[model samples]
Target chain A: MGEVKHILLAKFKDDVSQEQIDLLIKGYANLVNHVEPMKSFRWGKDVSVENLHQGFTHVFESSFETTEGIATYISHPAHVEFADSFLAQLDKVLVVDYKPTAVEP
Target chain B: MGEVKHILLAKFKDDVSQEQIDLLIKGYANLVNHVEPMKSFRWGKDVSVENLHQGFTHVFESSFETTEGIATYISHPAHVEFADSFLAQLDKVLVVDYKPTAVEP
Candidate 1:
């Protein structure tokens, strides 16, 4: 019923090269073109001043119009294939989906 | 030069009640009113189908106009005060700030 933000935080393996991570991120961003109901994809590197990030170095967020959209994306062949390679390079990963509720000023 | 998303993932301690969590979230959301450069506040419970959440249960996101804005927020008295009580009730917390780079379809 509302927009869902699929937030994923990842810590790449020490052995993985930056170039490989870039290619993997590119592959992830390209999924919006192949998946349905997935509205957009945005990502960024951690830039917090606080050291509370544990060990996560990157954040990948996918936007969907509905909860069902996430379900579809998970089962879609494109995501499944991408995830297989993506997960292999990550030392740790955390995925969470939330329907954002804005607090008015 | 770009908008930054200050993302925080938190897991409440086992003994904390739902009502207390609600109040904490309310206090968190209210920070926008007192802190400058904090453009918006939004949050949600983890509804992810994937069990990869690693134990994090809630996501709190605050939007800022720039990286400096986030720095200001980190030191702002309102935020620091809120973080004190908020962190006390959390079993774990992960924070990362990122500048969103959109991928065009």
Candidate 2:
């Protein structure tokens, strides 16, 4: 299997309710409900943890079959609409992109 | 255990070597060799994938026992030094801190 092409790890604005968070989770997934070229996807809020991993609020990991696939997703109206709706509520944003070299199994 | 107060999730500079990534992973954990009131920490680089997670670079999750504990960690020299060393290499940084309301089993 090929490595995922893009990953968007994010955190919502403080004071956000679980209900709102859940809505966002589903909304993003629903946007590109069945776009091809994507291989994997997942979203999560920061969970209660015992140690070392306490501060993170949410993480959304998605993978594409190729860079072209990612570009398509970015331009797709559904994806754009989702981004516009979800990101509008965020305060701090950090986005990073990478192409993996080696695979660990 | 108290919920960790601070969380610093990050991605390193693109083209960063695996060796460098490993150094960062161990370094952060080593910095607080044995601090109290803090509970968690973990680091990882973007991994190869087949679909949605293709472009992201790396993620580091760190949590503290209390807001104060995190504040202390931030001011602590060892932690400071470690942060200085590692953050110096990061290009894009996304830090988020959240207190859990409902614990999930």
TM-score of chain A of each: 0.95, 0.75
Q: TM-score winner among the candidates?
A: 1
Superposed model 2: Cα runs more than 4 Å off = A47-56, A100-105, B1-105
TM-score of chain A of 2: 0.75
> Which candidate's DockQ is highest?
1
**Ten contiguous residues with the weakest lDDT in model 2 chain B:** B47-56
- Candidate 1, residues A15-76, lDDT tens digits: the string is 99999998999999999989988888999999898998888999999999898999999999
Report the CA-based lDDT of candidate 1 relative to the real structure: 0.93
> What is the docking quality class of candidate 2?
incorrect
Q: How many clashes (backbone atoms < 3 Å, residues ≥3 apart in a chain or on different chains) does model 1 have?
A: 0
Compared with the true structure, model 1 gives a TM-score of 0.95
| Stretch of 10 with least lDDT, candidate 1 chain A | A96-105
